[model samples]
Target chain A: AKSVSISVEGMTCSSCVQSIEQHLGKMNGIHNIKVSLEDKNAVVIYDSKLQTPVTLQEAICDMGFDATLAD
Target chain B: LQKHEFFVDMTCEGCSNAVTRVLHRLGGVNFDIDLPNKKVYIDSEHNVDTLLETLKKTGKNASYLGEKSAQ
Candidate 1:
């Protein structure tokens, strides 16, 4: 599993956190996910062979959120 | 009884889209959404409490910023 972290903007409460999580959780090959509203970031674990950071970013975008892969 | 504004936590264009989608799903309520400002204006005659709870269930935090009489 490959782990990647991305910064997210505009999360104000726990519900916002839950929304992002619910959307991302539906994607295939996503092993685990954690989102912090206070920190404005999300960490995702996935299979590199089956998925990539770009794919994750697109998923986030599709759900109406911004995500940039952490350096 | 009135219109209200909320400062929504949205990250990008996608986030705005998601917020709009959720609000639109609520039957019989009208919403004026501003993506750039991350805000929503709702006009409804239904119970505000029900509306607020629906927003929360969709992963958005909404605060009552008072109301204005319908013009």
Candidate 2:
């Protein structure tokens, strides 16, 4: 598994954080997720073969938050 | 433009924020989010399917509740 950090925005509270984690967690490749509302970022661990930084970022973006892979 | 009512399972401010962002990102929408009621009323030129798809991006269960008369 590989860990990636994604910058997330527009989260105003814990519910936003939980939604990102819950949605991403259900995906096939994602193994773990931690969303920080104060930090405005998500750290995700996933199977390298099944997911990529871009895909992880896009998954979160798909959930309506602005997400980008951290450099 | 038509007014559409939709049910979104928004439980908190963050959930509502996600709705606001997705609709704003999709553009051509003027929406009102009622978090307490888990409802969203939107005025838009987009089709119901498109709007529902956009709302679902928030990772919330969203379904169209039919159109509302334009005021």
DockQ of each: 0.16, 0.67
Question: Lowest summed-lDDT stretch of 10 residues in model 2 chain A?
Answer: A61-70
Global lDDT for candidate 1?
0.70
* Residue range A1-71, candidate 2, lDDT tens digits: 99988999888877788888888989998889999998899999999999999988888877778888768
Candidate 1 — which pairs collide? A64-B14, A64-B15, A65-B15
For model 2, the stretches where C-alpha displacement exceeds 4 angstroms are none
Off by over 4 Å in 1: B1-31, B34-71
Model 2 clash count equals 0
Residue-level lDDT tens digits of model 1 in A10-37: 5666666778897678778889999988
